[model samples]
Target: MLFRIKSFFNLKTKAKYGLPLVLMALITSQTNAQDNRSFQIFQFPANKIPTIDGNSEDWKIVPENYIVGMDQLWDDSGKQPKADPKNLAVSVKIGWVKGLNRLYFLYEAYDDYWDFSLPGLHNDTFELIVDADQSGGPFIDRFHPNPNLTNTMDAYFSYHGVHAQNYHIFTPAVEKDWTMVWGSQPWIKNLPYANASYKYDFKPGQGGKLTLEFWITPFDYAGNNPSRAVESILEENKNIGLCWAIIDYDDVNKTENNGFWNLSKEHKMYGNASYSLPFKLMPLEKQYKKEIDAKWSFKVVNMAKREVAFVDESEGEITSWNWDFGDGTTSTEQNPIHQYKEAGKYVVILKIQGPKGISQLSKVWDVAVK
Candidate 1:
């Protein structure tokens, strides 16, 4: 009972329509076909897929609504300006349903061509930031898929030289429930730091995709001095994809590193897997609404004299505030203060919550004994 009433609708067109009736027809017909046949998976080389659409650069859909495509990780503009590197890839492609919020993302990240080129151990990083209605969202861990941490598919090294522990930083937000998602930022191992990687699934549509964009940046080392490397990567590769782009630096001049030749000639490893971003709409939404800026401001006074003893009623959005008057306990309030029981260097901390999120400030006060 194979009814091949094929018309002229493309995958992109079908996704755009997103009709319930159309979806039912697709599920019914496709499921029927699969039930009669044996299935096999086509494992591809690490760097590229097997085919491309003859009609367009767009990916063609397979029998199971499976569509995949790869481009040499382009610059911000989603245009391939260079050839795919043997040791690493700088491009990404994603396939998902129309109107659905969640989509699976396959990201390819690579670095220099050293013998130690291992996944998650290179000097490269990928970060995805989602903006909705022009506002920031909560900090979602884009690296881990589940609490079990079993699915470490986000990043993979070519040979095996990756190393690093994962960490999280808290921030403030104004847009309420705005999601700021990004992969781990790593340190480059060497000139041919070689290959590194990271990946994760995402909840989209619940927040709209128009405002979501990726910032492909490179940093020398993690520090406070506004690392020079960030600006360097941005200026050099601004032409990379904005919605989704491969963050590659070595191929800036569109030339592969000489070291790649040595690996190809000596190791008998000419082919590798290209990065693929196959997005799927996940039926999930965030559990908690984003908190106000971690920083907050309020007034503090002395109860005995009715005098404004410590007028900490500062003017600003304080998401979180901690006051320690040489005391062991701490309080997180808009405005907080402690009375001087004895004289000592009392440390005061104010975790300010603003549009940019949370920041902690500490000041030492010399409380004197009268």
Candidate 2:
């Protein structure tokens, strides 16, 4: 089942009739807090949990924040002045979702043609290069003269005709030579957890689109059993290095163009210094906590009979203060004393502005007439 974290700033208000609705909108916009040595990949929270059946319907509700364009490919030899016309015409949208303990991805590509007859990387394929540890150290370079597994994991999906196959390239800790692991494994699958169906569509004319979805667990390069439990990896690291690319075979036996998207300027055969981007994986609970903790704290004290003093205990710098005293009255003072004409219980809300963004707090105070 899909779980959603409610917005911390959206507080339920209890207001009497004929009063303007007291809306305290605390917008907590998250900035990329991780190191920005390379491009920072934002893992947007999924709204409509995708079924991973390759259908594009579920993705319709996802916000534009989760979508990025992969319309051009980097010239590896530095010979081509720009991405070839055959490749430039292709548009790719990449979406990411974090579920339970697994990471999900949806790759949608719009191309004029789709070729699956060629073998290996030469065919229509999607390559995912990941640095699970984000160590930024030595890794297995696919283009290296002696390519052996180091600290990188490469997953390749080749679509030929009606058949599709999955392949993984990594160097096992026990082995010195780089090993090419193929077929379905426990760690990786074409569908989300192998239970969902893979979706695909092809049109003969222009504006053809292809969509694919997959998921992966956490993997450790140094361990004997490299694939570790998702919980362990989450506990150890909050970010992972990732990059993706799409290979297009425009003509029947010729590799026409390669289009790259997100992370990296040049397509690194295995892993490149420019290829990996630090992707911050925020779980739902952590996200909620971060939003709630960013708020300010204030308390209400009975200054006198039928009167109360709102004390602002917020630290650091505050830009603005907005208070709604529930009795059709409001205040913008940092600390304001409000009086009640009649004995009753009222809900007091305070909205404060800070460096991170707006935050809110509320309390119910009882006023007694003298």
Candidate 3:
């Protein structure tokens, strides 16, 4: 929930006690979304999930249309601020699985002068920002709920990336870790939340092509602890706000980067999520999907009365539905509410019919009650 911060404990207490429903509403609201929505995040089949090995063999199934090449990026920050393939060329491919709330990335790039000798942020980097639900606003520490705490470290701890996340991922990380999460919650970059692997044969300064594969979980409310964090649910056809920029340091001793190419036209996208480009989580390709298929999900309304709600999620043109509640009861309703008299564990079934064909699904012990 959007709580007005009055004191330090107020922010921590809200983060700790913020209800998921309200917090999710506050984080996922699209009131301010400026939909420059251009990219699609491909959905990989469950059996074809890509292994994070920094290899391109697994990503061959991804169509060429899903690629975002250097042509799409603008040099938002640089002396010349222009796209030049002679200096560097980069292409990015993104994918996601239906059940997993994570995004997989394959970054391929060739740079004439690959500079990453520094141990700090002074390196060739792929900077990214993701607002998984398109909840747009200043996520960084530029603004404050209370103006008095504007420049204080307390505000930095309480405000930076509370709704969105930014990552400065080194192209070929040297002695340092894979990325520097630009926020208070650095733990979000570790395993269970994120991972990375780089494949390259050249040294730090050598000019060559580099392949990097990684996956990260986007959160709407990622506080200090995972227990209170709210991971953004990935659903079909949802438009997420995402953008990236490349910070290329051609020379090791140069104080400034040679070029900064970003998918966004504005450089303020680093601190503002509203400036992020749109990325739709695309559904499975027709090649892997049935012309007509049956699917469903259930929500328990009240366990005390054994009341359950079933909703149809079938694919294609469905005309009718049949539901078997597994308690000597059945219904023809597309979505039905059923009540069980006495239940231990019961199997549920759903059947659907369309002009193309017919399909059915059965869940074993997916519904239970006292």
User: Model 3 segments beyond 4 Å from truth?
Assistant: 1-37, 142-147
Q: Which consecutive 10 residues in model 2 have the weakest lDDT in total? A: 156-165
Cα TM-score per model = 0.20, 0.47, 0.86
lDDT of 1 by residue, 147-205 (tens): 44323433322111111111111011122212121223333311221122222222211
Candidates 1 and 2, the one with greater TM-score: 2
Model 3: residue 18 alpha-carbon error in angstroms: 52
lDDT score at residue 202, model 3, on the 0-100 scale: 84
What is the full ranking by TM-score, best candidate first? Answer: 3, 2, 1
lDDT of 2 at 133: 61
Q: Give the per-residue lDDT digits (tens) of candidate 2, residues 176-211.
A: 111122322333432333332333455322235555
- Per-residue lDDT of model 3, residues 261-330, tens digit only: 8788667899888789889999999898898889999999999999999999899998889899988899
Q: Using lDDT as the measure, what is the rank order of every candidate, best first?
A: 3, 2, 1
User: lDDT of all predictions, in order shown?
Assistant: 0.28, 0.45, 0.86
On lDDT, the leading prediction is 3
What residue pairs are clashing in model 2?
53-197, 53-199, 54-199
After the best TM-score superposition of candidate 1, give how far the Cα of residue 155 lies from its true spot, in angstroms. Answer: 31
